[model samples]
Structure formats: structure tokens, C-alpha cells
Target chain A: MDNYIEIIGFIAAVLTTAAFLPQVYKTWKTKDVSALSLPMLLMFFIGVLGWLIYGVLIDSPSMIFANAITLVSSFLLVYYKIKYQK
Target chain B: MDNYIEIIGFIAAVLTTAAFLPQVYKTWKTKDVSALSLPMLLMFFIGVLGWLIYGVLIDSPSMIFANAITLVSSFLLVYYKIKYQK
Candidate 1:
């Protein structure tokens, strides 16, 4: 069961982390952050940042890895939104 | 450090889970699931479901709570996409 848990955790981390990739790709490809909502992005960025901090504190590598990548991807979207959005 | 971690986890949970709300609301209100990509939503839904299973295995309330709400929101979006989209 414990092993199963770890496997699930790993799977969860990989999938969720990967889920953001398309949005990241779309944002990168089009350079169009207009469709993205500012408030929503801000909330997500902050949320991921918090998750990163939590992972660091918990000493959970899965959380750390997932949140770190998510943070970067989300942060990029926020940056693009600010830079490009009119 | 531990206390800080818990706080961060809570914060993370609140924000990320909340992040999905606007999309849920928008989908509910506009009934415009057309803009939403089916593949992306499916990926996200599976990811969140995996996360929820991981949370259950780990006995982490924060992860459980966050993913549970997210699962519902994402699932709703998926349902709407299939139901309303042309």
C-alpha cells in the first residue's frame, strides 16, 4: 500500500505538472496572454509558490518537484500576461 | 520551519483550488465550453484525480482538500464541455 501510494504520488506529480505544459506552450507560441485572466494567473502563481514552500518544509521531493516546475510555468504565464496584455 | 510549511500548504491549497473557480463560473455562466480544449481538460482532470488518490494514500488533508475541490471544478468543466460544446 505504501509503495502504491508513492507510485500514485509520482504519477500525480508527473501528470499535473505536465497538464500545465499545453497552456505554457500555447502562451509561448502565440505570445498572446490576452485570453488568460490576470487575477486567475496571480492566484495560481501565488498558490504554486505556497506549494513550493510547503514542499520545501515537508521535505517531500514529489511536492517539491511538482510545485517547482508548476511555479515556473505559472510564473511565465503571469509574466507574459503582464508584458503582453493590453 | 514545520509550522511555516503547514501554513504554506494551507495557503497553497486555498489558492490553487480557488484558481479553478473562475473558469468553473465562466463555463457555468457563458456555457461556452468551446474555448476549452478537450485534451487539456481531460489531462487536468486525470491529473487532479491522481493527485486526489495520492492525497488519500498519504493521508494529507491539504492535498485531499485541494484536489477534491479541484476535481469537482474540473469535472464540471469537462461535463459542460461535452454537454454544451458544438
Candidate 2:
């Protein structure tokens, strides 16, 4: 049961973290950030950073791993948002 | 120390979850989802649902709270993406 729970958490981490890649790729390829909100990206970046710190403090490898990857992708989105702004 | 750590987690949860609102609001008002990736939203919704289950299994209130709210906002984004597809 515990193992199953752990698996669920791990899968959850992968799904959420991996989900960002598509958006990043789409934005990178098209350079169309018209629909992306700057405030959302900015806040998400900061929020993910906080999650990273909190994960470290709690010593949760899954949170740390997921949030770290998410941080990078979120940063890319922010960069794209600025560079491709209309 | 522990209390501070918990506080950090709480704030992190609040930031990440609250971050989605602006995007939802923007997508709702503008009806433009050209830049929004459907795959990302679908994956995110499933992932957040996973997080909610994991939170329940682990009995983590913060996880449950954050993911639940994020789940709703993510759903809205998915709905908007479909409804406002360019």
C-alpha cells in the first residue's frame, strides 16, 4: 500500500513536470506568446522556486526533483514570454 | 525550525496554486488559446489529479489544498483551450 502510494506520487511528479515541456516547445517553435500571461509565468517561477526550497527543507526527493525540472521549464517560458512579446 | 519549514511549504503552495488564476482569467476574458497547448493542459489536469490522490494517501493537507485549487484552474484552462481554440 505504501509502495503504491509512493508510486502515485512519483507518477504525479512526472506528469506535472513533463506537462510543461509541450508548452515550452510550442512557444519556442512558434514564438507566439500572445496567449501566455507574463504574470502567470513570473508567479509560477517564484512559486516553483519556493516549492524547491520547501522540498529541500522537507527532504522529499520527489518534490525536489519535480519542482527543479519545473523551475527550469518555467524559466524558459518566462524568457520566451519576454523575448517574443508583441 | 519545523514551524518555519511548514510555513514555507504553505506559502509555496499558495503561490503556485494562486498563480494559475491570472492565466485562467486571461483565457476566459480574451477567448484566445492559440498559444496554449492542449497536451499541456491535459497532462497537467491528470497530474494534478494524481497529486490530489497522493496528498490523500500521504495525508498532506497542503498538497491536497494546493493541488485541488490548481486542479480547478487547470480544468478551466483546458475548457478555455477547447472553447476558444483559434
Candidate 3:
């Protein structure tokens, strides 16, 4: 049961982490982020950092992997925000 | 140092977890989800569920709290998506 649950965690981690990629791609292609919020992205970046700490504390690979990717995406979103501001 | 790190985790958890509120509020008020991605919200929901499981396995309150709140918000986003489709 634990293994099954762990697998679920991993699957979820991948899905959530990969989800950010498309948005980045969209922004790169369209360069339209009029709907995106700067404060939200900032908060998200900080939050991902927190999750990184939590992932380290718990030593969870899923957490680390997901947050690592998310951190990069959110960081880029900050730059995108400045570049593509409406 | 460990305690300090844990505090950082908790703080991150709160910021990330609470960050969704404004979007939800904006949607509630404006009924706008044109900028929001349905697939992204769905992926986020599943990922948060995974985090919840990971939190349980590791006995981490911050993880649980953050994921729990995020799960609720994402679930509502799904509903909001259905209701406010562009």
C-alpha cells in the first residue's frame, strides 16, 4: 500500500511539475502574460523555495524534483512578467 | 538550523498555499478564467494530492496544511473552469 501511494506521489509530482513547462512555452511563443499576476509569481517563487526546504527536510525526491522544476518556471515567469508586462 | 529550516518550510507552505486565493477571488468576482488553463489546474490538483500523501508518509504538518488548502482551491478552479469557459 505504501509503495502504491509512493508511486502515486511520484506520478502526481511529474504531472504537476511538467504542467509548468507548457505555460513557459506559451509565454515564449505568444509573449502575452496580460492575465498573469506578478505578485502571484513572486509568491510562488518564494513558496517553491519553501517547498525546496521542506523537500530537503523530508528528503523526498518527488518534492524536490517537482519544486525544482517549478522554481525554475516561476523564476522565469518573473522575468517574463517584466518583459511582457501589459 | 533544522528548526529554522522547518520554519522556512512552513512559511513557504503558507505563501504558496495562500497565493491561490486572489485568483479564486478574481474569478468569483469577474467570472473570468480566460487566462487560466484547465489542464494546469487539473494537474495541480493531482500534484497537490500527491503532496498530501507525501506529507502523511513523512508526518509533516506544513506539507499537509499547504497541500490541503491548495487542493481545495484547485478543485474549485475546476468548477470555475466549467462554469466560466471561454
Query: Would you list the C-alpha lDDT of every candidate in the order shown?
Result: 0.85, 0.85, 0.83
Please, what are the lDDT tens digits per residue for candidate 3 over residues A1-86? 66776687688789878767888888888899887888888998899988887787767777787888889888888899998896
Which 10-residue span in candidate 3 chain B carries the lowest summed lDDT? Answer: B1-10
**Cα lDDT tens digits for candidate 3, B1-86:** 66776787789988887777888888889988887888888887888888888788777778788888888888988899988896
Model 1 steric clash pairs = none
Best by TM-score: 1
- State the DockQ, from 0 to 1, for candidate 2: 0.72
| Greater-DockQ candidate between 1 and 3 | 1
Report the lDDT tens digits of candidate 2 across residue range A1-86: 87887788788899998887887888899999987778878888998998889878867667788999999999999999999897
| Residue-pair clashes per candidate | 0, 0, 0
Per-candidate interface DockQ score: 0.79, 0.72, 0.66
Residues B1-86, model 1: lDDT tens digits: 55665677888999998887988998899998777888888888998998888777767778888999999998998899999988
Clashes by residue pair, model 3: none
Candidate closer to the true structure by lDDT (higher is better), 1 or 3: 1
> How many Å off is the CA of B83 in candidate 2?
4.5
Q: Residue A52 of model 3: what lDDT?
A: 85
Worst 10 residues of 1 chain B by lDDT: B1-10
